[model samples]
Target: MDIFEFYKKMDADDIMLSFKGSVTSELLTSVLQIIEAKMERLNEPSKIKKKVYNVLVESLQNLYHHMDKNEQDIKGHSTVIFMIGNNAKAYSIYTGNYVRNENAEKLQAKLEKINSLNPDELKAYYKEVLNNGMMSDKGGGGLGMIDIARKSGQKLNFRFQQVDNEFSFYSLNINIAKQ
Candidate 1:
């Protein structure tokens, strides 16, 4: 790997933090604390800070809870990748993880459905989901993606690539405006 190239890319993108490894609850807390502290020290406006922090929390939690069940299937130690950055206009977060190939279609459809909604529609959908009280075994009411969209005020960007017949890589990107 070209270390300098990686550094140059990160520098150009103004990356605040990046990680690639297993996602665990402990690491999640540490990263969130670090991000909160950094945002505080930067003197970012409270609203922007909160939005960024919320999106980060949801993003990490989604990976921690919803990542593929067979994470140890010959993939080695690494299981997820997360990166956060800020440019002049917005703060960006990107996360990628392995997912069961069978799940890719459903997830993509859900995300597409979420991305197609306007703010008001999203709010209504969130309320409907809340009222229906349907949750996955993981205890998600299917609201994380909606909450991320509402908080960031941007459509989520995502992609899926087949890794094998049994696994696929899922990546999601979120951006919060500084305005």
Candidate 2:
């Protein structure tokens, strides 16, 4: 969709909660609590709740670790925004954070690779990477995109917004069905 349409839909959706700040462990916990409470209020089934919870955790952790921060200031923290919403067909989770320009190209390539695969191919590729790829200190093992795609059962949607010469804002969207 075009940027205008995307923004319009976001504005129309019933945003249960939206958080923007440094993604520390404490902030992550608070965000999870808010999301869980919203899911509870919606009377979502346990199976759906589990899926949503897992996806949320992984997404937040990805942001906490991979997001780029300003280098000029020693105390500058990465900016992250998380939003949860539902439409007639699916529940949507969106995350936005800054990423270095160099990392943006790499991230785009990774996402494109994931988006190109079917379920079977994605599973096979994920296995291949898990078995052969070097793991980061966080133990990501290049699997976050695959995991998000597998759990959401949908193609990941992403975009990069230029912030300056050195970095851009990266936004990713994952959707899960109501059923």
Candidate 3:
């Protein structure tokens, strides 16, 4: 591996933080700390920092709580890839993890529905889902994605790549403006 090449790539892409490993509560906390410190050192504006931090928390939690079953179908390996980027206009967060193929369709549909709504509609939909009180086994009441969208005021960019018959990789990208 060319270390310098990787370094240059990260620099070119404006990636502030990048990690690929098993998702756990401990790692999540550490990542949060690291990102918070980085932003502080850069003297990031309070508004943008809070927005990035909030979105990061939800994205990491989603990975920790809902990533595909531990025993991955892909060579028995399970991991999540997460990155945070900083550019002139915005801060970007990206996360990727293995998901069971069977669940891919439902997730895609849900994401599409979320993307289809306008800001006001998103707020209303968020309230509707919150009021319904229907939660999943992981304690999510289907509010995380909506909250991310509402808080960022941007559409969620997501894609699913088929890995094999049993699994697909789901990737999500979110951006929060510096202004």
Q: Return the TM-score for each candidate structure.
A: 0.92, 0.85, 0.92
* Candidate 1 positional error at 161, Å: 1.3
Please tell me which model should have the higher TM-score, number 1 or number 2: 1
The alpha-carbon root-mean-square deviation between model 3 and the true structure, to one decimal in Å, is 1.8
- Cα error, residue 86 of model 1, in Å, equals 1.1
Question: Please, what are the lDDT tens digits per residue for candidate 2 over residues 71-165?
Answer: 34323436679888776677788999877788889999999999999999999988998999898776477788899899888899999988788
lDDT of 1 by residue, 1-179 (tens): 99999999999989989998878889999999999999899899999999999999999998887544455553562478999998889999999987777788889999999999999999999899878968877746788998999999888899999988877889998999999
RMSD of 2: 4.5
Deviation of model 3 at 78, angstroms: 1.8
* Per-residue accuracy of model 3 over 1-179 as CA lDDT, tens digit each: 99999999999989988999878888899999999998999899888889999999999998887654354444544778999999999999999988878888999999999999999999899989998968877746779999999999999999999988888999999999887
lDDT of each: 0.87, 0.82, 0.88
lDDT of 3 at 17: 88
lDDT of 2 at 42: 81
